[model samples]
Target: MMTQMMDILGPIMVITAIGFLLGRSSIGFETRTLSTVVILVATPALIFNTLTSLDITPETIGTMSSAALLCIAISGALGLLVLVMARSSVRSFLPPIMLPNSGNMGLPLVLLAFGPEGLQLGVAYFFVVSVVQHSVGLSIYAGGLQLATIARQPLLYSVAAVLLVTWTDMPVPNIVMVTTEMLSGMMIPAMLLLLGTSLATLKVTDLRPALLIAVSRLGLGILSAVFVIAFLDLDGLTAGVVFLLATMPTAIVNYVYAERFQHNPRQVAGSVVTSTLVTFVCLPLLVWTALGISERGSGADAQLSQAMTRTETSLGATYTND
Candidate 1:
């Protein structure tokens, strides 16, 4: 188990470290361009391919979707309290605490830990985060609800297309599917490398608030995941994925939002760097713990077991069966 956990985390740390080193060495990689490519090209293809290819039913989608929304809502609720206590603006603080790095870090971690089915489920969670971040997160940062921003995200369109194809039993042309599959392959590594580069550029002027918020985000996330999993009856891989995601650090993009809105960019950058470094130390233990808990089997565990059994029985294919 320890070895497996290490295998999952080892490459991530190494790749991110490389990016960090490159940045420190004054090697100029156009991170803004890379970020745009990831968001506009690689990530959307990955999302579309994952969603379209997965053999998930509406129940599975609902379960994952519920988990995602619950995750965000609970985090946001706790963040509201934190904001009140800190007496800070939503623009400066709420986003980092409320939104986990579901795309760059959370997705890759789950993909490694849980495999393709797990990645599919992770995408479901990412979908909700993307929608919420583009819409609600933007609104908070922009000081008003920018409904139009949601329409501008390529992921949103990819999601819609994937859903339409999934629901209608429509056949995607082979060429398109192949193209997306090729692009999807690039998503994880690119995101991780991009993460390192982004970390390289982050400047932390104040460690006190950054550390406080970093701890608060991770601490509140665990509490929220526990409540949400039990309340929503998620178990097995789904529960494990939720728990792991709950432990993820703040998104690097929050700094972008902070910088765009002039809302304490240094503080946001500090939180990003602090939480990401903290994630490096915490992820292996957290993943191992989640796997152990899921294996022990409870309410959600039983459901997940039964669901996997049904899937395997019906399809004659193996599943995670843990």
Candidate 2:
């Protein structure tokens, strides 16, 4: 399982290498602009397409929602811990710490790594994380909340697009779907290119803090999974989904938020860059090691026994009459 995970991480590492090297070569100017377009237009379409394609039953929706909230809760806890440890106020420390780059980097990779299941989990991550970041993250980072900003968000567009697909069997306009797809297809590579551009701008001395941030996320992530996932009875693809999303580095949204609200945008940006780079290796490891097929815990064994008993039942009297 570990070897298989390493195989999957190889492409990610290659892509990341290209990103970093391109930036290092100072040829990433065009790539940065292309990345902006991908984030503002294409990536959202891809996410909407994936989310709408899902057959979100009430049970599945509940599970997704629950998992997302759990993730948000953990994120909040971690951010607060960091702020306190640094002797920084919650109002100044959280926005940079809480939100992760789920959209620009996480969505596309998740689709590739874990397929539809992984994509769905990414969408779930987007929903919960976005809501929490906009609300709780903003309040903490700014020392106040703003309801109007939430009320006026463009995110409703995604929700509308998703519902349009899910509730109807009608065919989508060919041109529209194709355009959306083209945009969506551009998202991953463009994001990597932009990341490359960013990396090129940083000096070696500037990267020490980034390294520390990455190690912090990875180490804390390991601890969080040890307790939360084992207690939750999630297994197989679901377990993989949870761990993959949970282990993602501080999101790019934090950078955006920091422009307006955070005390140290540089630190936030550093964390985002560092964590994302490391997650390429760490994400696959976490999924395969912590989330793959596993025996359900103690109580689950009883449930399995009951299910087997039910499966064994039959209307036939067998040969007892003989």
Candidate 3:
């Protein structure tokens, strides 16, 4: 189990460390340009390629999407309570608490831990989170619903195209498939590198308030995921994917939004940095727990199948004897 955990985490840490080193060095890169490319090009391609290529059922996709939504709702509710009690700025802190780093941190973790199928599910969860974050999350910061912003997201189009193809059983052009596959390859590594770079750049001001919010984010996240998983009776890869993605740290994007809107960006940045640091410490335990849930669920399924087969065989023999 330890070896498996290391196998999953080792590559992520190494790549992130390289990015952190680069961030500390004099090397220059356009963070916005790279972020735009990932969001508009590579990520959409990754989602389209993964969903279309996988033989996953629509029911499974819906379940994952629903789980994602539920996690957000629960987290938001719990976060609102905490914010109100603490008398914090809802606009500044609530977004960070409700939303998570499902893209930068989540995709790679799920892929490494659960493989391609896990990546597929992770994409689904990321898709839902992205939609909500851009829509409702943006509204909280901007003080209004940003319909234009939501409509402009490439992820929405990518998911729409996926559904169209899936429903019609249409064959995507070979060239398009090849192109998306190529673009999809770069998405995860780019995200991880960006995560490390962003972490390096962000400053944690006011450790007391920052740590309070950070702990709230992680705690509400885990509680929300647990409640949703149990309420929805999710298990196996689906449950693990939901749990990992749901429990991710406060998104770096939240700080960006806060800075853009002048909504206490410093405190938001502090939360982002501190929450990510805390999550790194807890990741091994999270991975272990997720893996255990998956294994136990799979084992239960296998046992049930065996029991049904035995029952059928016993009934057949009894009828023969009669």
Candidate 4:
């Protein structure tokens, strides 16, 4: 278990660690430019490529969508409850607790642990979360409902294009597919690198609030994931993918939003860093549990197949005698 865990998560950490070291060194780079490239170029290409190329069935989309929405809704509600009890601003706390680093951490982790199908499902969940983060999460910070920003994001258009192409069964040229795949390939490493850079730049002033929010994010997320999987009857790879995604830490975008809106950026930054640190503990456990479930599920399937084969053999012998 330990070896498997390290093998799966080690590469992710190594890449991020490189970025972290660079971030801390005299070496400097424009984080905004990197973020823009990721958000506008790499991410759109990745989403477009995955949505168009993967065998994303209605069942798969529906299950992943349900899990994403349910997880966010449950986490947001719990965060709101805590904020109200503590007399804290929802704007300052909820987004950090509700939103997660699905892009940076969730996507790559799922891809590594569960393969392409898992990556496809992870993207579906990520899309749902991104849409909500831009619209609903933005509104929470701005103190008003905002949908225009969501409409303006390049990702929205990319998703639309992919859906149109998929629905029409358009034959994309090999060059286009290859180009998009090449661009998409950069997203995971860039995202992890960006995560490390973001963490390095962040300064934590309010450790108490940061720790509280971090713990709440992970705790609420796990509970919500359990309910979502059970309610949706999600099993096997889908269940595991959704659960790990649910447990992802505060998104880097949350800090961006917090800084933009002046919603306690320091505290938000602290939460982002602290929650990510906690993932070093929580994520492995989630991965281990998910793999165990997959193993048991396969065993049951094999047993069922054997039973059906024995029944067919019995019936065949009876017919031959007749």
Candidate 5:
């Protein structure tokens, strides 16, 4: 089990480590742009496809979605508490502090490690966090968002997907499913490669603050989620996924917002790299323990867990793409 996990985790961490290195280098901007493109386009398609393609059951989706929402609520609240206690206001720092680096880095890494199961969990995380980031976090960050910013959305599409499944005897189209799957499959590795390109340009010393802030934020978020997961008695995968997503580094969307609004991009960037590096170690351990890996698990269980994990990646991609 440890060996299998190490295999999955090692490459993911290595890519990010490489990314960090590249990001500090002279070629950083060009690499960052390409990474952004992959995340904005290829990754979203992967998410949509995986989310839609899996044999999605109401119970499964419900459990996963609920976990995600719970994590977001917890993370968001924690961030606010930090802001408040530090005598900071949401207007100044809450949004960047609250939002995790879920896209570009999180999406790609989840795809490679958790497969379909990870994909599903990642999408749920994205949906809930996206909302929190835009609504509560955004309101705090921007003073107020224009109705136009809020209006541009696919809220109804998510609603219709659920309703379509509930209201009638219909199936998702095969062609659409295949197309999404193909495109989504390309999302992770491509993004990682681009991340590598980005990292090749940056130096390590300049990014220490980003790491420090990310570690602090992620540490608090994970501690909060761990308490909730224990209180709720979630399933192994559910519990692990919840903790994993909660531990996601500060997300890029917040950084962009920070950049646009004249918030501190340095803090946001530091958190992204720091949280990411920490997540690689923390997540696998959390999963191993939460999933009963040492107790309810044996060799067979690892294999079974592996299968379940794959569903998260594959189905999540479908659901997101569709």
Candidate 6:
């Protein structure tokens, strides 16, 4: 189990460390430009390539997406309850607790732990979270519903293109596939680097509020995912993917939104940094736990299949004797 955990997290830690070092150094790279490239180009290409290449059905995607929504809703409700009880600012703390770093931290972990099929499901969940973070999460900060935020996401277009191709049974040209694949290859590493650099830049102003939010985010987030998995009867690879994505730390975007709206950005930044640090400490256990759930679920499925076969054979034998 320790070896497996290292295998899953080693590459992520190494690349992110490099990014953190670079951020600490006087390297004058334009983070905004890199972020724009990721959002506008690489991310969309990655989503398109992964979804189209895989044999994932729309129903499977829908199920994962629904799970994502439910997890977010449950996490948000839990966070709200805690904040209300503590007399905290719901607008500032709620978004960080509810939304997660599904894009930056989640994709690489899922890809490493569960491989291509898990990536497909992770992408579906990420897509849903991204949409909600931009719309509903933004509204929470902006103090108004910003449904228009969804229309601006390139992820929306890529997913639409995927659905169009899937429904129409259109064959993608080899060149397009190759191009997207090449672009998609950079997505994970770039996002990891971005995560590390972003973390390096964030300052934890007040440790108390930050720690409170961080603990709430990870605790409520994981519990919420567990409830959703059982509630939705999710098992195997799907359950693992959902669990990992849901348990990620507060997203950097939450800080961005808070800074933009002047809604306690420092506190949000502190939460992002604190939660990420805490998540790293908890990652090994989390990975082990997720893998265990998947394995047990798979075992349960195999047993059920074997039992059903045995029952069928017994019925056939009795009918023949009759």
Better of 3 and 6 by lDDT: 6
Tens-digit lDDT track of model 1 for 1-322: 7789778888888888777777777667777888889888998898888888878766677788888888888889988898888887666889899888888888888888888988988887888787787788877888987767667899888988877887788988989989999998988888888888878888789987787678777767776777787788766788888878877889888888888988898999999998887676656666766675567566554554443334224322211231
Candidate 2 positional error at 297, Å: 11
- Model 1 vs. true fold: TM: 0.90
What residue pairs are clashing in model 6?
none
> RMSD of model 6, in Å?
10.5
User: Where does model 1 exceed 4 Å of error?
Assistant: 300-322
**Which candidate leads the pack in TM-score?**
3
Clashes of each: 1, 4, 0, 0, 60, 0
Give all candidates' CA lDDT scores: 0.79, 0.59, 0.84, 0.81, 0.57, 0.85
Q: TM-score of every model?
A: 0.90, 0.74, 0.91, 0.89, 0.73, 0.90
Better of 4 and 6 by TM-score: 6
What lDDT is reached at residue 196 by model 4? 86
**Model 4 poorest ten-residue lDDT run:** 303-312
Candidate 2 lDDT over residue span 1-322, tens digit each = 6576666666556666687787777543576467556645765676676565555544554566576676656666875687577665455445544455566556656666677777776676666666677677766666678888766554546656665665675566777777777766776666665665666554333565555556555544544544455566665555555555665676666666665764567766776777776765445444454333233434443443342233223101211221
- For candidate 4, report its TM-score: 0.89
lDDT at 244, model 1: 80
User: How far is each candidate from the true structure, as Cα RMSD in Å?
Assistant: 7.9, 11.4, 10.7, 11.1, 8.6, 10.5
Candidate structures ordered by lDDT, highest first = 6, 3, 4, 1, 2, 5
Query: How well is each residue in 276-319 modelled by candidate 6, as lDDT tens digits?
Result: 98888777767766776666674354543443344335434543
lDDT of 3 at 208: 71
- Candidate with more favorable, higher lDDT: 3 or 4: 3
What ranges in model 2 sit over 4 Å off?
A: 1-3, 28-32, 54-58, 146-153, 164-175, 202-216, 220-233, 277-284, 290-322
Q: Which ten residues in a row have the lowest lDDT in candidate 3?
A: 303-312
- TM-score of model 3 relative to the true fold? 0.91
Question: Candidate 5: lDDT of 106?
Answer: 62
lDDT at position 27, candidate 1: 62
